[model samples]
Target chain A: MGKEKRELTGAEIFWECLIREGVEVIFGYPGGYTLPIYDALTKYQDKVRHVLTRHEQGATHMADGFARASGKVGVAMATSGPGATNMITGLATAMMDSSPIVCITGQVPTNVIGTDAFQETDITGATLPVTKHSYLVSDIRDLAHSIREAFYIARTGRPGPVLIDIPKDVQNAKTEFVYPTSPIVLPGYHPPRRATGEQVSRALEMINEAKRPVILAGHGVLISGTANQIRELAEKGNIPVATTLLGIGSIPDQHPLNLGMMGMHGKAQANHAVQNADLLIACGMRFDDRVIGKVSTYSPKSKKIHIDIDAVELNKNIKVDLAINADLAVVLRQIIPGVRVRKHAHWTRKIKEWIKDADRRDILNKKTDVLIGAQVINKIWEGTEGKAVVVSDVGQNQMIEAQYYGHDEPHTHITSGGLGTMGFGLPAAIGTSFAVKDREIWVVVGDGGIQMTISELATAVQENANIKIAIINNGYLGMVRQWQQLFYNARYVETPIYSPDFVKVAEAYRMPGYRVDKIEDIIPTMRKAQAHQGPVLIEFVVEKHDTVYPMVPAGEPLHEMVRRPHVPSDAKEN
Target chain B: MQHTIIALVEDKPGVLNRIVSLFRRRNYNIKSLAVGPCETPGVSRLTIVTDENDSIRQNLVCNNLLKLINVIEVEDVTNVPTVIRENVLIKVQVNAQNREELKNIAKERNARIVDEGERSMILEVTESVGKIQATIDVLRPYGILEIVRSGKIAITRGDDRPEIKNGVAGRGTESSRATEQVNNYLY
Candidate 1:
């Protein structure tokens, strides 16, 4: 493929490529270095909408959220130096989770690039490890092609962030805009979309022979849009389906065959099933250290059949018996036809018994005097009818939402799964709101995580993003606090951090806010917030020391979970 | 165990940086590296010698190298029947006494006197890694002032070639259609 040449400034060419790539919105913050691009943006304002973010980090995360929610390439823009450095965490988060985002940062003018000029930074070098690929567009003629390539690389294959750092002079330089007319060509980058016949046959053979097969579904299932196929495969073979945190909504949480999330803090039944299953079919998800726990002991009994698009991921983590490096959707389509209808009655009966035990320890079943994070998440789920898009921040709040929110649809639950970045919820929810206009968007964040990027409240207000923010105010970094309490002789350390009154903070941002200390006020306040048309913030002051149970301490095997302590009689006492 | 890997990559700016950074990030220790333009235009070739004994880790490093967007192809030619060479230039302190002895050593080791200084003579040697070490060992009796060695370069002895594992083979043709056909066959 060649280019269609036309005369335009590099900045204008950037916008032209973006417009042709179908970018409707760009989450960005303008600065001195990026003035030329912002200036060019004025001419294309109608075609491309720009949402000014509170910080460059927010912009990156919003772009990430937009990509995850919309399944499209999300774009974020920032200037050089500090602005570019600030987006590192967000870019790393997106990269870790395989979210498709293109971040454009303005560099100093080419002549002074290495002189340490005002607001100049080596952003391409800085982001090289975090980004899937990065470019320093020094030449004006390469501007359009770089932007196109960035978009293509970001959205295709194992999707991740791709950064394009354009120098100021390059943006101002006049050149013939050579827009790529055909599909961009990259010799090194080929995303495999199918499995080999031998691999598929071997996988089918394993699937047919195993009495207890467990499908460990990951974010790949959702990314490849193979949830239906996964469900079909599970039903045809009566295989139990377990999901990673990012894979939560791929299989409906309530499906009979669904074993829920599997990992540390995952359901006890899911963990046990993985440990006991004869055949472990890992689909679209890497066996993260967190998911696999002690790798040597992880799924020790299972003969593994691994399917993923990324070839590097095949034997990188757990050495599987059969590795099928291909797209999950295509692989599932091929294998589902060969899988015979079978029954695993004994395995199902065993899992049902384990589920009963896990349900007995369910925190929601107990009555507590004070509010809890789990209850707040469960109530939000109820209020939204389990239909709202929930963006969760890291730590206990994220786990609580994953456990209690009960996501029933794919893309409904968006979180920074691999990186576990705090302060992701609000901006991500805002991005989700932009991606999905009609669906109710919710931010489930902890007080600690929310404070990390609390400034995004203003972004939500300015964008008029109809997102309901739920701050699980536990007055501590609950996840760390739990670890300290359990493993560090209860030394609280700096976990007990203070926070400003969130309601007043929300009000300062010119958005309606409410604080709920009692369980009774939770639903009412939530209802009031939902009734509001714009962004609304609700602070739920939960029990300070409540922990996320079913904890599999680091290096422990999947089945060796520290179950939630059973409050035998009255649940009133702490 | 030392492994020799060769890669063909797009000769674009920062491509070398990406490859080197990937090695650093992955903690794969590179014992020696040499990069130059290959027979193909606009495609650079890299020969890297990494000290990794684990076969799994070696495979991982090769896979990670291929993950780089500029890297077109990668192959570990350690176990293959191949011709490998390293060129070394050693400047040995000669003076009047040891000059003839140095010349005799260079001739015996198939080395050449590339440069001669007032008091030191530079001998260039192109040989296998072990032979180069042997030549250097023989010249150690004369005080060596400086040494520069091309890391490594390797090629197959016969017509054996590394498989085209990436999308380079689909170039010029409609890659989308080619990919679809490949997908159909694989699926």
Candidate 2:
């Protein structure tokens, strides 16, 4: 009838809290400051699995990747000072994309928290801007509740990363741990879940009245598990759907109404549809500058309706006519009953017309001498049957992956969207490996980004992650080079970033690594990667001059796109 | 236009630094900020004023402040029907010649001479911002030495208690999904 009597040290309570929270694995690295938890981890090694990452950033990204892939809150751990500092980028990335991840970092002993003792840093102060919430726990009694609160805050109301900075003394202290069976109730926090009837009716009236309407589905749809609801709403209304870069796979990419990725490097029809639509229904997506080129001209004819779970995101950019601050699934499901099914054959045909010259403009058309970035991704797409969880680094390869990968399921494609942080691919894919044990995990990275976090290869090998890494080796930071070639007088200053022998590097990790250059070698190389028993790395030397097409230069209208240059057969550069 | 915002936050170390940094990160300048312990056991209230004209920017700052972990609630109390006050202590240069004049000004303004020196005297007053500004205007006649003033702090007037939804009652010691506990407090 009273509290259960269980005596445990704070470190033991740490692992016990994780087990109670349903955490099956942790991606982390141990250091001096984290000895207590690491020591306690040894006892609970059978209860919870821990994956050692080469770098703290890699660990957080892995956790993020796991969270994205499994639709569960991922956990990362590290020690004090640099360990917590290194997690900044990953935590920021998770914050940007609304990924649910909890990072636990060790602090110096409570006595020296501010004295700058060995390996001590004011992490809570430093990470305030990036994390949804953070707790600096020095008392053993507060340790379990802080962790429980961290998990709760990280996963609810537009999921994000939460940090728990536990001092070594707290971890070593012993307390009567009653593993908080009751939920943590923070007075100030509440996640909005449902839309008002008036807002729904207003949205429906706009939907019914529109002649040319487009639905912009975003990553929120995936987070809220509303892909089916979005599909139903789109299908019932016969509205074409355009996806943001992170919004990819929210709806089946193969669906007829799915207009593919939209924004700067989005497909032609999708961009055109957003520009021309009379009514734009934005579901679970924020209209970032990357998605909407110029707020003044975006969807010029549309009366916009923005539906998002984060109330704070509505009208932050591109003010909408009707804003529904609620869960995407809740809003979509509520409105589906009130929504009337209709046909918009002419509108769909109009959009299809913009997609007319897709064949000649397609990357598949480059079947000549050397390999292109898109071809390599398409090959992997074919080998994996468009079902693999494709994690990509930012830049040219990221764009090409978007252009080529035929995503068929939600949570199948993970990338650094809001932050667009480079060097996220390898570790994130390794994290995804733990999530879908049976499915293929592919890493589409660039030569430049691969070098940024190449040390992650050690983690991949250690975990024996069943992943296939395809490095689009262009011998340069291709995205910057493309931007230079287009905008700044083609001065390739510091753009030609050379990388060391990646095959040799992969060899160091003891995984089979191959360099594929010829266009014909793409498929065979991808197939070989799939056949490898463990993680395999393939460096495909692609054309350095290649660029992502349909470029809507920043600050310009979405309708204004610069097409790729046409090279005649006689005017070959190579 | 100026905006005055009141925020309730958890009483913890480095909270002021966090709030100030958020403003700095957004490149917004704070005119003044005053913080003190509230009636609640572990809660402090912050009253901040910034010289920003745009309501949208003001709302954004409020939203961002609300996102901070320790922040419980934020409200723009400027131009509202509320009880607002600031305290000012001005140590002004004086002699037998100007002391009578300074005393008259202080008495007219309902101020008091809390401290006095041979060459200077301190005028202390707790009043509305408008009254404080008026008093400062009156004190300007005398040579001012050092001035220290508390920033604006406010509470709503009358039966207009804009729900302190994050009351002590919300932090239940019982176990429940954070959301389930939050459901009772949803506005």
Candidate 3:
């Protein structure tokens, strides 16, 4: 069959490529230069559903939420200048969390570029640090290839955001278009494969030889779909696994070998194990500053073996005894067989003893009448049966959720980690609700953080998203207050936050709201909020000065923790 | 250790400011820098020399320069043999008595006589720093009027193509030849 290739504009090619990539939805707002792409999108309404956002920032966060929830490349479109600049924060957030997103923007016309024309800005230049890669389409013919490449780059190899800026003239200019069906080949962009045989053998030898070995799992394990493999290896070898904050769900928390989280605000036993281990098999995690407090002192006695997908991150921070650059799943698949099925009865017994000792000092068993943030989050987790998509805002509430919430699924808990953007949860929840409308979506935010982007409530009302908003109101920025208390000699300073009646605000948006002050009313209030027809906001007044326990001071090793600043009487008991 | 780094960045507004800010923020010591238009539209080439060690230089290349959305490629040319040149146009005061001597010196150095007014003569010299300095020394006798020198631009010797290494087309590797062809056709 003879088929003639016809000329197509960049805008047309972009739509076609997006359809080919199975992009069913796009969130964006149109402007002067982006009108052509919008026109093309109009022609393909059946193939793609475009969500018009109130602002560019909302659109980007929506894309981010979609990506985080569905594990697919989220797409957003915006015009140049302020439209593109507003997307930088969202893009950076996605980049940090390793979410796949593609941000498309319009550029000034080809002829008037650099002339300071109306609605012109170098969108590509502004997003360099935040994106995995970027392309500026000056020619129409390159649009199809660029879009395909953008999708590939965004979805593969340490998944992150990629941007493509198309000039107005190029969008209208026509060329022969060919949609690529196969994977695009990019030089110098190959993601590392499984570890070599020598590396696996060396790793196995270390695992078998060590008397005390711990697995430090990170988000890379979950991203690579190696959680089951990791579990199998850990179970077979009787290795205790400690997870980073982002790696919370890499292994089920209920698993006996799981040591919970490590570092500041981590479980006491988990941090202790990390500090005292003889060998740390760090899998799929970059040792961020938070994880390795006082870098020189962290793991002073342990030999660290780091495995990561990005080669650049292998030795960028803490030195590794063995650095293997490979996909976690591939590496795990290969290493699991080589590992000898040996039982470290001594190591398992020691960890179990520590866990038992920790259980005796269980903070939840104190029978406190006052509701706490941790208790509230734990109740929500229990009520939802660990099935809800939990979106957390930054600060103490985010840390508490990371510590206490039991995540049984991948991408279940969405939070802004690296950037730690405060106003991330509400919009992110709204976005998550859209991605999986039938599932129960909950936004857990602090009073201070919620006030930043509370206006997005109107978006929930408009979209009819039945999202449950849980405000852990502590009357201050709890995390900052805790830091000030410890580091700043308890001088509260400007951490205090005063807010209006959240019920009134929710009512103003025609949504239901509730306030829970007593510890006994927490579960019932959450139940009522969940039972509400549309979006519901529940405010919980937590203890004003309560601190998250087992905190490693700013530059202290994980095991050398303050133990929750115990009262004098409790200290006497110890 | 002195090192020369070549980078390709999108030619956009405030790029220079961002580059300067990055250097200042990262505390990287920059000895010299040159920026100019490249063969591809919308992209410019920058050559910078610094005295930082290899690791620090690599950090500057990967973490700082490459972090800039506009910057597409960064390469270290410290170990590569290269030719560096700059153009300087100097207007000198000369009379009939010393004109012949100055002209002879200029001819010897292959400098071009751009303009000659009644009071002064302007000579354009394109050469290495040492040769340019020698020519300037020779012309100092004729009384230098105005001197303006462009920043040093460098290219590696032999057939090592920096553009291809930087992921630009023309001399890309075998796998990238298709992209090169497409890029060529588009441009």
**Whose lDDT is greatest here?**
1
Q: What is candidate 1's TM-score against the reference? A: 0.96
lDDT of 3 by residue, A1-574 (tens): 3434767877888898888788888888899889999988778999898877767777778888887777778898999888988888889888887878899999899999889898888777677667887888887877887888888778776788999999989989988876665446563354556676778888888888887899999888877777888898889888889888888887887898899988787888887788888899998898887788888888888887898876556667787788887777777887888787878888888888877766665556555667888888888899898888899999999998987788876678888877888888887887787678667899999999888778788877987777999999999989999999989999999999899899888899899989988878878888888888779999898889988887888887667877743343343245
Clashing pairs in 2: A182-B175, A182-B176, A183-B175, A183-B176
* 2 or 3, greater by TM-score: 2
TM-score of each: 0.96, 0.95, 0.83
Model 3, stretches more than 4 Å misplaced? Answer: A1-12, A108-119, A167-177, A180-185, A353-357, A437-439, A532-534, A565-574, B5-27, B33-48, B54-187
State candidate 1's DockQ. 0.34
Better of 1 and 2 by TM-score: 1
Ranking of predictions according to lDDT = 1, 2, 3
lDDT of each: 0.88, 0.85, 0.80
Each model's DockQ? 0.34, 0.26, 0.09
Report how far off residue A378 is in candidate 2 (Å): 1.6
- Scanning candidate 3 chain A in windows of ten residues, the lowest lDDT window is A564-573
Worst 10 residues of 1 chain A by lDDT: A565-574
Give a tens-digit lDDT track for model 2, residues A81-122.
999899999999999998999999999999887887988889
Alpha-carbon shift of residue A27 in model 2 (angstroms):
1.3
DockQ of 3: 0.09
